[model samples]
Target: MNNPNALASQSFDLAAQQHPHLLRSASYNYPHRCAFKAVDDGDTQTVNQRLSISPLAIWLNLPARRFDTALGRDFLDSLIAEITLRKEAFGRRPVTQLLLRHPFLHYQGADITELMHLLASNFRLNHRDNSPIEYCAELLLEEAEGANLALLKGLGFNEFLLSLPASPSRGDYEKLHAIWQHAREFAADSLGVRLPYGYPEQDLHSMRALLDQILSLKPDRILLTPASELDRWNLQDHIHEHGSNSASQFALIYNALRHAGYRVLGNDCFVIGRDSLAIAQNQNRLRRTAIAYNSVNAADLLGLGPAASSQLGSRYESNLEAIQPYIENLQLHKLAIDKVLQLGTKAKACRVVADQLLCYHRLDIHYIENRYELALASLAENISWEFNAEANMELMRIHNGLLQLSDDGIMRLLFISDTFLAGLLKTPKKD
Candidate 1:
């Protein structure tokens, strides 16, 4: 196979030349491979001796069908033993110091320790880090929540909310109030003392009262959760019965909050009319607030669990799924990898592009060009795509709201969907 580093080098070169400003200190070069020297027969093999070599190197040199065969599993197990002994040493080297030198290597090593153990055991890595035994469990939990939010933003819900914030114009509120009163009188007589199941007469009265209260509060933001039985029914069904009453309610509430100068945040999924509430900010205030929903997209995600998975670039591998196998393998100084998959480069590129688009919305054409050059130089270019100037225009049109072309003719990200953002990794996804 062609060298991955060479390809990466070529891409990096292109990106560096075009967007030197963006990649001030980014490494465009890949690490070089070195030959291993045989140890003297007279010398004893100690933990320090094992730490001298790269665990990745040991795993790569294994001949078990390259992560698919029994031999590969054994190789992985051995690698884990070496890593466990060296973990403390590894941690002793402050990450802050490393970041000062190589700011782009953002992941923490502790996150991948458990996966190292699991890989030594010849089991499939689950890639889920929710277990108590998992190292860096807290970090993984935060990553999971961020991932979920990214998914939500990707579904275009953010854009929907952006539009809904303007629905409650003062004129519209007055109209809604009149309509509500009229509906209340009609319902009072039509039911003749029996109210609707979900929409009882009292509920309408309550809704009206709530509206009044909201007007009085004049909050800068209002969050509402429909605690009534109407919430259980479909939105379409509610709209049919209420003749845009729900829509008006949303609009009125939103506009009321806006007039009151509060920012509103909520969704159709909200219950109890309001659960968690907060003040809203204007565009200028929001830009300064630095309030971002959880989102992360990184090239790899390494998880550590009895059975954890490590997603390297596009490839995914899992270790033994149970604690017993993992611990036993670790005791034996073995790797637990039980499953491995190689993904297509297109898929990998798509993930990368999706993440980039979601975060910044604009593709840096010059950056892509330089990256292509660097990939070529490094011989790590595993994927092929037409990333010329024209491609940038096409991508912009596809993800309209998320990206914008800068004055320099490079793509600049505009508004990334929370879904895509969540997928981006702020830390290493492993452990």
Candidate 2:
């Protein structure tokens, strides 16, 4: 059998060469011109000026353009197939049925007409059924409308358009609004109940109310997504500069949720309360925190629209941002996975340590040593002689401080005011 390791090394080099710009862009200190521009633009808009523009108003007038292209679609398909093969080979267990059923996992990009055609062809090829595909297409449409509404609200245009006078612009706003409203209504009627809005509200009271509702559901896991709220608010401001009332409401809501004991899990994802804390703390205490939950645990995260990411195990895949490339790729039966990273044990270990330290402000060295079979003394030995002595001697350092060694010979990182968990997690930059 062909060795995957040999293939991976070759693929890695090929990927690096093919996407030199992206590879180079991975450096942490890369300067961002757009950020500087945004900062510069922030001061120019007055509150009155902000009031005139709805965050989503510009997009309302802008064409409802498709973002993915044929090339991108084909690339994504091929990529998905490749990644799926790799996942089956190396992943710990069979991809769960729950994962396959998840909304995020089952997501295919929004161009319903295109997706329908593709589904129809697949049905024809298999000669099995078309009902599932038909149902999925309808579901996809509903999801698209929901996303559009989210974008509208997030961009601050939802309120702005609502506040607009009856005019051509208002008519345009109504057209887009009607499309999504109808979609939601259709879904409700078909599903036989009101679909729960997964998104949090924009007011503290409303947000708290939403949390109470979520808590009542007694979910096994909760994802905290402060960044999504922030992004929506920020994007709204960017759309017109002054920011919208809806975005302001969103920010207020997000803050309230955070105050109510939601801890961030990953980017734009959070889990609620003591349960999440307990899980994280236990993982930290056990030192298997890193291996337990991570990108690998992300069952199926399907990209719903353009420029979105989907995660299956440790493999993260993305779709093309442009409409043309996405279409062309799909026409060619390809999946647009522009980048792929098959994380190794070392990388996974680093991620775990980083996440624990960052979230809990502590580390269980005993847990790490026991789980990974690496000794703290050995780790200390690897440090330079001077730093090594400091680490070794610090075993008897002051009590109740930020850094401490437990009775079991595990290192405990307390609330060290000056230090951040990121420093410990990061790997040294490769020259």
Each prediction's number of clashing residue pairs: 107, 37
Off by over 4 Å in 1: 1-302, 311-315, 341-348, 365-431
lDDT of each: 0.29, 0.30
Per-residue CA lDDT of model 2 for 1-431, tens digit only, reads: 23323333343344333332210101111111111111122122223222321111000010122334423445435434433432322233222111111121233435322432342332121113221111111122223455543432222111111111111233434443455454444332111111111123244355445445444433323332222222344432332432243334334434444555655332122344444334544464312121122221222333423344443333334456554565456456555434433334443444444444434434455565455443332222222122225346432222232233322111212111101121222222221
lDDT of 1 by residue, 147-227 (tens): 322332222112111001112446544543443343233221110000112232223345555556335422222224331
Off by over 4 Å in 2: 1-93, 97-222, 227-316, 342-346, 355-362, 366-421, 425-431
Best by lDDT: 2
Please, what's the RMSD in Å of model 1?
20.9
